[model samples]
Target chain A: MHVRGLVDGQEFLVKHANGLANGVSELQHLFPAGSNVEDSDALPVIWEKPEEFAAAIDKAVAATQKFVAAAESGDKEAISSAFREVGGSCRGCHDTFRVPQD
Target chain B: MIASGARRLAIAAGLLLQGAAGAADDDLIAQGKYLIHAGGCITCHTEDADDAVPLAGGYALQSPFGTFYAPNITPDKETGIGNWSDEDFLRAFYEGTNPEGDAYFPAFPYTAYSGVRQDELLAMKAYLFSLEPVRKEIPEHDLPAFMSSRLAARAWQLSYFEPARFEPDTTNSSAWNRGAYLVRHLGHCGECHTPRGTLGALLREKELTGNPEGADGESIPNITGDRKDGIGKWSLSDIEYFLDIGMLPDGDFTGGSMSDVIEDNTSHLTPEDRMAIATYLKSLLPAD
Candidate 1:
């Protein structure tokens, strides 16, 4: 949830990269059962197309991995590009898989 | 030598004409594509599935009146509008009449579409015709008994709808006029953003102030210049960036309907057009 906050402000890019690198693996397992809460915005496609959903998660993980390496390099240009990739990965998944919010 | 020269001239003229025709077709299709983005047709036409066929049309739009299923707009011959003539298409957008001369529910936003130029509508049709045809037959609308009749739509049109083209204000800048055209005609932003009267007529006086009961019963935010209630805090760049990527100035990506709009419509617009829209939004009077 705080991924947006961390990735958005360049000041927090380093912190976001660290958090994503450390937390993405755990995030992958968070939706193990495909169970949805009453107020959850997770779309049915997540459960229906498990393979595709898993692939999307893998993309996020891969993007985050790249982002972490870029952040560690301490290069603003590289970090920015990596951060954008990570954001793209997240947005790509959310566009079709997530339930729309009100 | 004279005969050869004459033949060469003929060949050159033919090639020139062919090239000019090709360029014109390309321009028409490109313009159509842009107008489609502005119209946000995909948002309602395509289902919410990740792999949903674009423009295949099975999205169920829940309105207070009823559930209206968007019909397939792809070039499929049987179930879609593939066989619709240019006049058929024009009539639908200009007069809210279907190919069969039946009245269309206002959910199609033809009221705003009526303001679009004839050439622009034709370009839109050209773009739609260019799409891969999908044969999807959407279910008919499920409406309340009182609102189910096509007559109801026709009556509504008589009461509130006006078939008119967008007229530019000579006093405004070209950018402002462009913005007005996009927002008021092609974009039809007011259809959702503006509050409606009891009979679903748009409250023009409160344009862009926001709608409490907007599409899908969601409360749309005020986009006017009100500091507390609207996007007054956002800069022009902020608006442009948000439209492009759905990212707020506060660093949060938007969710819900606006997100879909950003992804499908505004995101595809050129920077100049987005700036034009921003200019128009900024000029609006703040309303509650």
Candidate 2:
């Protein structure tokens, strides 16, 4: 499918990106820590660098908000740019905090 | 005084010739700039710092061998390749050697660059020479005892390297040929994507299959045409758009070293070129 498809179907993306905040607030950090989750690619850096992780989560949330605003405005150019930033924010966190996928 | 007709014609001819020459030089330099980007020089040459100057090499490359710092390629006479003559420049790319005729470490990716045409290499050099010279001294590579000397690098080159020019397949489409040239030669995507041999040489037979032990402890994703194993699911436009903006078809952006590559190299490419790359990639065999 085309990137147009991605732009048109922004709900899943918006939800996925914005949900990072929920991860930051409750689900991301555990009280005991160092416990293994089955089938998880969660890297230790996520827990180790809580401050940086929170900041990354915040950036992603902000970018996703901008993306939602851009989508609502119906300006294709603005939407595309905001969508890219949203993607970049996701990447910014994934590259450092998450596990490197195969 | 009115000039004679022949003299006036001569002067006019001279001006025309000079103008033509200047335009040619401009085109050459412009082509060089584009080629340099295609060659993926900036990402490696520029240091990983906020204040890092472009092409004033201090970029640290972490490989299985060691941490290899990219040297200054800026036109600083003593610290850079400013003093390299045209022949020296060509040798660097074509022969994978330095101006002094010493073999360079394969970390430079001259193996792929060896396939670049001589004129294109010169064009890349012309563009580099036009840049503002930065006299930055690069730190030496941190290597183990076995990897210490130029001799070791020379030995590796002797074993695995072959200086060759890219020969186009006449049967292929122009777009395919262009894509091949960019992917295999200038872009050198296979250097990281293609899995390596025990000796650290690229496994040419399995190009774009993705490497498990890539630089900086990352597993490079396979871009072959496999539906399950590779990028067969990605449409040509999706690939092109991803190259342009680093966004995947699923709306996720890559956050790996591929991010820097997209920012510095592929995004700057023409849309046509990116599509051509997609075309070539689409043609690759699926992993078994």
Number of the top TM-score candidate: 2
Docking class of 2: medium
lDDT of 2 by residue, A6-51 (tens): 4466565456435644554453345236664656666777768778
What DockQ values do the models have?
A: 0.24, 0.52
Please give the lDDT score at residue B147 for candidate 2: 82
Instruction: Tell me, by DockQ, which candidate is best.
Output: 2
Q: What ranges in model 1 sit over 4 Å off?
A: A1-61, A64-102, B1-12
CA lDDT, candidate 2, residue B170 = 93
DockQ of 2: 0.52
Q: Write the per-residue lDDT of candidate 2 for residues B1-288, one digit (tens) a residue.
A: 356888999999999999999999899999999998888999999999879999999999998888899989999998998899999998888888887778888889988989998889898888999999998999999988998898888999999999867899999899999999999999999988998887688998888999989988888989999998799999998899889888887766787798888878998899899999999999888982
Off by over 4 Å in 2: A1-58, B3-23
